[model samples]
Target: MKRRLLTLVVALTVAGYPSAAVAGDPLSRMTLAEKVGQMVVSYVYGESATSVSAADAAANEAMFGAGVTTGAQAVEKYHLGGVIYFTWSRNLTNPPQIAALSNGLQRAAMADTGIPLQISTDQEGGTVNRIGAPLAISPGAMAIGATFDPRTAYDAAKVSGTELRALGITVTHAPVVDVNTNPRNAADGVRAFSDRTAHVATFGVAAERGYRAAGVGTTAKHFPGLGDTTVNTDNGVAVTDETREQILRTHVPPFRAIIAAGAGSIMAAHIVAPSLDPTGVPASLSRPIITGLLREKLGFDGVVVTDALEAAALGDYTDEQVIVGAVRAGVDQLLMPRSVPGAIRILLDAVASGRLSERRIDQSVRRILRTKTGSPYVVEPPVVGTPAAVDTMNRIAARSITTLRSAALPLQDGQDVLVTGWGAGTTTNLATALGATRLYTGSPSDTVIAQAVAAAAEHDVTVVTTSNAWADPTQVELVQALLATGRPIVVVAVGTPYDLASFPAAPTFVAAYGYQPPTIAALAAVLQGRAQAPGRLPVTIDGLYPYGFRAP
Candidate 1:
């Protein structure tokens, strides 16, 4: 068997196909089964038996049996081309453990087909980060935008890429280039850079360059844009009303700029743009958008990856249909497919039956192999979470704090200050860091509101943290009730700038963009006058503030 495999490898190399394996060209030697296997990216729980959820642990055991644990078994069985890691997928306790997991997965792939696997994760910073604690926290994209410095955006990506590279992760699904024109957009709140095309293009390209400099491949995501939709495609379908001209002008520029900067991949959004595709197909499965627009018009030759196949935006499409449609639409890789084994079988059957052409399969497989081959692979683990990483995060956070309204910094030494709001952990952190006199943890309830009001009466000033107050009526009412107290209050919008629109009467309002520890600490620094809040608004909120607004 070894001799036959070697002969096939030699023949493929002679045929001019570049093999990703160190020994020889695996693709040239692969059977249709092996080739189809390379197109599907799957997931596995990397948490230990004791760490994973009860249901997940049981399901994993059922699938792989008693001794077979981790994603290694699945990689060997399917000869997978890539594996995407979530927070639960690995022991993120330290850098060494993550390296071990990545090395183990690659070993499994090499043993099966002499091919290395593309290890990927969503390291978009802020709330979307998959690698938990100890990794340097960033203030996310919007905060970077608020600073109005492309260098800060570049440095943030560079630091994140360095950390991810140390963890043996090769691809970061990041630098969301969506120009956030809609303040109410749920899925892309602070993930986007700005509502202005120039800012998005400028900062987004800088971020891509940073990732490339660190030897990490970057993905410019949600092609055709998800910025105008109020719905979260993860839970339901989202439709965009922008005309083709509008999309080309606002949403498409950032993607075009990043692609021109040599982004390795682009993730197609699941949202439907009826104006762009009159057929109403989701961008993930639309041939015109993926092939006609992105490939032919924009001339992007990089790999096209579909967003999570399980997203509700697909809307009742069978797993078979989703898999086949995406492939037909020019997607090179199917991310987080519902069933890996089922998808492989369907693709194999499609190829055999002429439903999907072998040439088409070859097109995507080649792109996948090319990306994996060029990825930065570390043989020896490197040190991560260094002091320098923390310092960079601190500098970014300090610069990103935007004070849109204020009546002389409310936080002062030895003053009676109360910190309260929805995200209990963030509120507590801010309160601790600022040395507030009291901390009030409450939900958006009348009882909670009344308690907050009572607590405010005793404090010299109240600092309230809000998360999406514009969308939640309860939060709106809570702020209204607090405003009625006649106590001097400072409102901190931790998630989105739109929250300020709901409480226009707020005496002082600051947009932190996200609640990452660095961001919270920065907010504390600004309030205490230890640091300057120079960040400007990245989006316009009606009845509140316009883009580029910053307090004097």
Candidate 2:
């Protein structure tokens, strides 16, 4: 039986399909470089399926390295374990294009390391929706949470994951389980499911279950929770000053729940919590947090991925320090290093210099390969767009449109309406639904503001849209200008639900929770009384609405 399994591994390797079948103690056969490569999942440049041209290979040279384009050469060169896709990275173009890229990259990975590439994207629905239009966009975590139904979260993930699987994307860094406790949290906003801890746990577990059902890998992210932070880790250092009590109550429960749900992966946040680990290291590099609290205490035996190795949260440290630190901290995969080749070199050197033991590397590789083989990284001929996903988005959006103050709702038929707000498609979409005479497209200028006020006077009803009015505050001028018209004003929060407190005078306030097409259309339907407002507040609006408050 042992000899037969060995023959199968050899056959699979020759066929460019090294898989869990090869997991029969394959670590003993792996070179140090192959093991190191298996731990780094980096992004490559260009929009093409293969970096065919010298120019294509050189496209991301300045950023990644010379003669090291993974989209072409580096996947084989470094034996990369996986790849991450992003719209800005040109990895995402259209449906077929992305699917082709997924297939092409996977082939390269198999040819190099004989291991399937765990291609991933941060497709956590809502404002974080990566592949827009032509693809099915699902409601985000917060919107699903507002329904007060775990099934909505499950349905959204399943639908989105199905589309994602069709794109040949095997893993999704989704179901942001971060409990958005701070209403003014700069990092999370509607990305998190709710400010409530238990609700976040419930919704997160549901989404993970949905992903499992869809046969796609699920990663519950920012493990120590970034819900209360004032800064984004992607930009700079973020500290979550949650006390021991707060950590046990607000932050840890969601992770505990998702781990129990058998999450495929958990991403460590680049947040420093003095209480969680007195060592004062970021969660991603803190052994107390990742290895101790998460792995030992919570009993999460899955892969542990770092939040972006290139993130500014760890900018203060050198590249070598960060990589070595992450490995020591028990991170399974180092995501988006500033330079993939640099990270590969760093890890190889760390092991050689006795800074990191090979046993640690082996542990991560076993988990990663297990996940890829177990969830099994479904790489089918991607369907791109599906009717099922579209239907899911529409239903979730319709269900999540919450009306806080409905005094000015069910606008008089054909009443002159002026629609203006703070997002691109949000206000225009609302205007089209209401059939407004004038559409002010969220361009907050003195001239635009004046024109909006004038138009508000001409129209019987003014529907104003806001995109995180709590932070930007630019929408305040526009809302205040429209308010002076002495007309019935309806504020539609197309981004975050906290905008209502910013404009208290508005007679009608609706929370669409996002600017997705389905969400905007749902906002229009609710305001027109064509559909009923059914969503409850998932987060507390200080001094006004409490969590779970809907129209009485």
Candidate 3:
């Protein structure tokens, strides 16, 4: 009779929660454990978690920090509403595998919790593309900006969403809407799609459309813009000097457009936009930026997420301080905080003590709930990564490879290439792609120069690639030394094209913009004359290359 009662209890529990749609309605019926779970945003390693049987309850304990299991455990166990996919683990090599793993994890998480997981990934492409899967192609925001068409931005989103959803990610933290007007910004760099306000607006709108079409919800990021700021939010103080007019006119357009297009979320930047809030509180924890401006003026009603609280950008503040401040600032999600269990206690205590209002928690929870089952995310995952689609992604990326300024490429056969750069990854990859049996001497030492001269004696072309001054001066000097050698040198600036301006003598230079493997391969192909130099410069190179210069 006792056994019968236990079996009946299990059956009643299953019957009580039929689906996610109805599960949310009884949110008030949940226990204390479930309510605390909803406040968490944590990180996990897919490969390491793969070793533990996902079916085991112990797997949840092992994968998550103390007390949490799967992200769904936050939902089922804690009544959590969301989880942001952090990519600190370097092994996620391609989109297909990442998609499959993420898809499986989210599916299992939702099944465990009886609530849909707000699964997200950082698919910004270029320097920030996290999923190596074929579905989520790595096309940076810059490429979309260069296209200057909402359709291009939309198509990239659609493709990205198709891949993300297949892997079971319903949310994508992307379309970095920061207007990068500051030439010296250390963080945004190429992460921004454009500096032009209207152009950015167009791209953001299209991106929202594409993600929606692909059945994935979009999040417009780095609110209040990090583009013109001179500070790095992760480890340094940051402030944007844009006037109120400039802020509203230039930086806010993209956010407004994407929001209007029904983007489900907006990620507040860690940088300080003092015009919006002069206390120097970073936008991520500012009431004016989050509630006053984003919610009131621009009329954004979706979830407001903070950039990773783990970023050194917030400085001196304790984790508890940051979490409480973000919630108070009207942020709906606290992204990737260092401690989930600790944060939950902090938020709950704050609410119990009246430091945070219960009404406020309800507001954020409603937005999060609306987003997970949002209209844009009506479907689970969209079909993406067809052979043709993959081909299209590659082609778009190849076409977006800005050359800055260069003489004809693919050095005539037998050209002696002089290559110098930090990190073995960039230099060796370029050599293999160009197929040049060239001499590689990394240092400017007397012995190294002597060897390089000897190697180049038999070759007609020299190819040199290096990080711009943004890295080290030695790299620039090395390129100058090669130029002094009077070899037919071709210089490629992997970081920023501006580094070449300091060059003693500008040889035929090509700006590949970034050092991703595919970008390097495409660049080498252009140098070997195997591929056409079809991409034009997306930004100015000052003295070395003009802003709009391109070579055929």
Per-candidate TM-scores read 0.93, 0.94, 0.84
Error of 3 at 89 (Å): 4.5
User: 225-246 in candidate 1: lDDT tens per residue?
Assistant: 9899999899999999988999
lDDT of 2 by residue, 255-321 (tens): 9999888898999999999998898889999999999999999999899999998888998999987
lDDT of each: 0.81, 0.81, 0.66
lDDT of 3 by residue, 158-240 (tens): 87777777655777888788887865668776777766677677777877888889788777888888888777777776778
The superposed Cα distance between candidate 3 and the true structure at residue 270, in angstroms, equals: 1.1
Give every collision pair in model 1: none
Q: Which number leads on TM-score?
A: 2
Tell me how far the alpha carbon of residue 154 in candidate 2 is from the true structure, in angstroms, after superposition: 0.7
Per model, how many backbone clashes are there? 0, 1, 32
> By TM-score, how accurate is candidate 3?
0.84
